[model samples]
Target: MTEAVFRETTADPRTQSVPLSHLSLELGHLYMEDFAAGPERLRRHFDEVRIWVEAARASAARRTGGKRPRISTCFLIDDYFTRFSTPAELVPLILKEAEEAGLVIDYLARESGCAVADRIELAESVMHRLVESPPPGSHGSRPPVSRTGWLANGQRTPTTRNALAEVTVWQPPQETAARNHSVFMDVELWSEKDGRRQWSCPFLAAVWQLARLGLLRHLGEPVLTPRPWDGEDFPHDWDRLPPLLRLNDSATPFSAYRTCTLVPNRFVAVEDAVRLILDQTDVDSGALRQVAERSAGEGAAVPAAVAQRATYVFYEEPIDSSLSEGT
Candidate 1:
């Protein structure tokens, strides 16, 4: 028998261990249209969110065996989709309204951060990691999601048929894991315009949720690590602001073993798509191992499945339905 030893240093990769809190609680999400309606919208949004915040904290404490759990509150602004007023003009208003409702936003993030944080193309990386759920009888002949730009909880209803096949009619899409009824969903991950790619909202939101769950990494290094902010004045341009900002110095760690997001009912479909995307993604194994180890050491371990680690509270939107049209 011949024994040879040839090893490459890069063969074994290590992930950066980020501080993981018990729960990362998302207080609310903001869109340009919400701001366009002025402070009243934000005031109403946070007022509704305040009660849910307390409830989420209590739930986290229960999960931690009634011990005081480390929970961090965060808010995401949709600066990627549409730019409204500058950060300088809009951020203070958001802060004031949230404060008035007795809610402190420990961290603030821009939606674009999930797309590209600190010069890393996070959305593209996540797109590459996606492992789509195959329907029954699939034999792995389908194109990868990176090329298809579409993901579904199950196989999409056929729009075309084999030229030589027998007579057929349109078929209804079916969920892969349906119990009795099928709730099929097909999500467009991105679209290209003039050679420039535009990621969909739900795709970006899934990356954002992965970041909050401490499950995201790029090339073995953590991405979207929060930068400290001491309540300083924000820049007039949205691009000047950091992707993730730590508004409160004494706040819990930004990354956590689990996450709870509170959003308006209008976002249910989007959030459902986010979960579907996450359900099939082959997340970074090194990061997953780290989270598992750290969480176990903390006494309350996270779930093995990434999608199961997220929770959401979809409350009623605090605005007139007609005024929210096209928003």
Candidate 2:
């Protein structure tokens, strides 16, 4: 009799299920510039965002057929590009402003977390999953030539040397989804300096959106799980705290079927780049199926396309011009 072989299970991966909410709403985003302008600036930003938050909640409820919808609110603080203040100093100011604005932030995350959280390189993993959309007349004879550190909607004009050694005429880039004329956009995803890579703001923002949608995983484990914050004072240093902090224990789940982000109109370009990146990324199949199955069971199915599940509301810049600029 021949001996039988047994298969090992280390290769198989499974995503841990997170409590699903009907919507995850981003209340506001803070950058170094916003913090430098002082607490007054933050209060103004949240005051404007609060109005949109209510609108988003109403829209989510309507989407769920007017039933009580589970919604979670989150805010992102910019600690990656430049650290302005310590968490002990900044977190309280943020909470105070939000409270004054009649808004509550259930979850707070650091911008750096999108690049790496819990020793996992979420941005790098997402970069590996990018599958560029092929332009028309593609016959599969050759793979799309994607430029390193950049993503574009369609093929870019080539720069080749002719037999006469003369430069070719410049051709305008085109968008694959344009109806008549092309408004092409080429987004930079990262840059290298001194043998280290810096992830772009839009790239990290895209990762943040994916995390909110519950589509991110590292070897089948959820990335950026919110750590509950006790009543004790926040750490003096920023790095002492976890990437994500759950401030409200009674708040709904952070991950949800859909997400609505309220940001300044100046971020329209960045958000557009984010959509381009998200449209190309192929998330975990098991996680995707799980969300689909669960959402359908609740009688509110989500969109098949990952990009379609995200919505954004771009508001006018606040009175403070200094806060308008920056990530």
Candidate 3:
């Protein structure tokens, strides 16, 4: 029998004519967290949204032969966290619920200002402010306790900043000693110091609190239960992830031709949500097949074809609190 012939085509040109976005899926979003997290967090999220938009814009541009396209994005979030009684407790609950639901939270670097801070000094300054002041109008008191020399600066007041950022203080039902209901705070910022190389301490503490309290883990499950992580799923199972090629459609009209598809393998379970990012390449298929054929007899496996980037979508219902309703 004659050798199989393969035909390859480059990225689709139509992508330039359409709009694309990298779907910012908010699985279990806490609204109070959004408002209480302060402008820096909000700004970070906004910046992240723009980055995805720009990436898609670049992809569309290339598909249409350098036609830069106007790309728009839809932010999808599952407002499941609203059911939790305490807004402050929502984060862990949301994370756990997401884990059980098999959803992956892509902590896009663009969404968090903390992700941008590279130095401990920057982290400490930002965290100090977050923990002390919070956002505006959220807390009833001022920055509670200031240990660092940062307060020496006259620019910020402890009380005013505390009042603005405090979202809520929860009092739990189980009472012990003088404490009755646990007081929950809405937004909290934490940072690492220069001497201590532990920038992740804050995040870890938050996660541990959630995990220990069984907030994210099911209430019935042991508090020590491990939360689901991205590495647990497919593609991640492979010893190595294929090199990622980020392409942008630089043209305005936009086309669907530039994209890549993520295939599942022994290491990872192919996820439907991730499939939206594939792009069609302009390389010749015959050339690709010939290469594959040449490599096969020598023990190389025939490589699977690559798909273009596809669009991802996520949606979350808005919180209905009296505070948020007005917003």
Candidate 4:
């Protein structure tokens, strides 16, 4: 009798290989507050970001041993939290201001894409992959402690249920990696409203970072693939545009070995929380190994830890009186 042949094609998933660049540089990010401040605000933002763009390119070149690096620049718009204007009216202004500032934005993306892109629940998949960093004295006996819809750098103070319980002193939060003192930060991943889950900004930003690093996949296929834009007019509605759009035909690939984001100082806290989330996320082992192998083969080895591969520049906020007030 012939030997039996069996195969499970779906069991082994494969991630599609994307063209890699030495660095994926983020020129800037715009939120509803910035947009409300008007076109002048955007012009000021690009002017400040242009200096850092050059610096980031130089840094990437040094990391590649002075080799000409394939770098891509992208911008993110806040269409998730609040939709201020239509893409048709807003995109052209952004491109024009960026060009005037002597900068080119190769790709444009919407913040909502991180939550869901092309019918894929990207944030939910990322949540499932989170493997928290176990605290000291963690034995295999207890399940990993996690606050639902929240991530913290260290253990939090226990909650007391009984109203008659003895009053306990407030305990200061601690950072897991703190040396002498703790600078703890607890980030909210999501919130439930009317049975619908709303992802937080920091959480979405973490997903964005993973995408740029080529570490996100839905059933082994890359998520949030950039759809080419033919330089025609943008759709009147934001939803009509793909989650990620490639604006420049000659630009390098969106995903790369490393990423650098430049934003205003106001986003420093949010970005820090993004790092905390990224540091603990356990990405697909196959995808992780593929990136490591390919990057090393090109003589540009990336950081062993995913969080370390990202860099950020927090520049001064534009001098606008309206920006000083909360939106």
Candidate 5:
């Protein structure tokens, strides 16, 4: 396997200004690039990146616990690739990399290292693991234990399965409301099976597709928030979404859903554009009042401050009463 190389940069002289999350995000982008390239590429990148990250972590652990920290890592391969020979390969890759990172940090710590230096180093390592590991287990769970076999000493036991979900919002390109790859596309996807492509299905199919893609591999049910554009009629009228938009696997905001037009255009940097639009708004999102009336049940209440700025500009009329009921 080709090895990954993570060359260390000059230590930031100013440490207080950096956000670890931001660093993780930077690494996340780099990891995404490797993922898009190929598994061999990802493996090589992970090997190199894991060493650099662990070196940092080891430095930190020295200052904090005079010990090394081990990151337990795993990867979920896209299900469509299961039949292929390489589908099971990522499991060991993650395990090996995690072990290597932990070892590197130990070596770094034992060498001449200052607390500040160690902290910076360790922070980098943790961020590397964060980026290397898929987003925290946001998707649901593993499949069942086989059809139906349950018992505690011959007594039937209940078998449970967790639901997986996410919210993927879209942003549109400045010029038009058309779906384009330049403006959008997942940041990265593995190209196994000789560049085999995956198709996305709508509604339940969409959810199933996400599960198959390893995108919905969260270990728990997600806590969904209404999109800024979600109004009483939003869920009901979701069918009006473009065919591509209809393939959403989460409770993504209408604006975000519509942003898929940009995906095809390669404008996946929707966050940058959204930030720009938010800059133009005088309305304070944090202090907006609740505009919609309350629905019955023990659902979480929408904070008035947040609700005030919320708008339903894109939703169509409710077509399904079941959907409108908001289960």
Candidate 6:
């Protein structure tokens, strides 16, 4: 009788590796309401975004020492919290507006994919990895943030007290990394209805950034790898579309060393919360190492901190636009 020796090796496919671009530039995000308003809505948004996109590209070129940086553009549509139109009717319109603005969307993704990409419970997995940031006066004990579904920049002030309890002064929340003055923020991570759980927009958005940064993995395997779209007709249903779709055949890879999102001013606070989540969430070390090694091999300097790798440009929304929370 013989026994085979089990040894862990790097050759295992579980350690999924993805191609990386120098930058993943997000032109804008789409919502049902945004698109339903009309193509003019998409046009105005992209028209304003076109100039900023050039700025972002120029910035990336400088970072690469005047080299032609490999940049890929992506757009995300909100399909999880609220589904409005199918891919067939929505994608072409989005592409048309981007083209008119002299923009190219190399990749497109669905918001719900952040929650469950390719059948993987990505949001839940990220939730488990969240480690609350310790504020100035943090002790060994902390709040149950995952259960409570709330995350704050600093310790929260107690809002309730019994009459029998001793009187005390009100404590204002402080930002962990605040300067002389405090700019505190508290974000709700998710909500529950009946037995099902719904992830918040910021939380899903954070996951989306991680995926674009190539920092996510499922049991050592990459999640949400882009599916190629060869100009074939898009599906009538959202589920039929892949979590990530590569629209341009000549475009660079989906994942990148850094990401820059050019979104409406309305999403600035949401992106801030996303950065908060990234600062606290612990990503897979192996995946992080892979990104670093590959980037260095190409003589690029990727930021060490995952949270700092993402940047955003807050552009003014059109005067006629009405921004909604779900978007």
Query: Could you say which candidate leads in TM-score?
Result: 1
lDDT of each: 0.90, 0.88, 0.28, 0.88, 0.23, 0.89
Per-residue CA lDDT of model 4 for 1-327, tens digit only, reads 899978898766777776778899998877888887788999999999998988899999998889999999999999999998899999998999999999999999999999999999999999988887655644544344243787878756544355577666565555668899887877899998999999999999999999999989888888999999987889999889899999999999999999999998999999999999998898888778989999899889999999999999999875677656886
What is the Cα-based lDDT of residue 326 in candidate 6?
47
Name the candidate that leads on lDDT: 1
Give lDDT for model 2: 0.88
Model 5 Cα shift for residue 110 (angstroms): 37
* Model 1 per-residue lDDT tens digits across residues 62-126: 98999999999999999998999998998888889999999999999999999999999999999
What's the C-alpha lDDT at position 69 in model 1? 99
- TM-scores of the models, in the order given: 0.92, 0.92, 0.21, 0.91, 0.21, 0.90
Model 2, span 49-166: residue lDDT tens: 9888888999999988999999999999999989987999999999999999999899999999999898899999999999887767545543442437888897666444665868
Where does candidate 4 stray beyond 4 Å? 1-5, 137-147, 159-165, 321-327
Model 6 C-alpha lDDT per residue in residues 107-187, reported as the tens digit of each score: 999998999988899999999999888877577465678778998888777554556775665767778888898888889
- Model 3, residue 50: distance off in Å is 3.5
lDDT of 1 at 152: 85
**Measured by C-alpha RMSD in angstroms, how accurate is candidate 3?**
22.9
Model 3 CA lDDT for position 323: 50
TM-score-best of 1 and 3: 1
- For model 6, the local distance difference test gives 0.89
Which run of 10 residues does model 2 get worst, by summed lDDT?
138-147
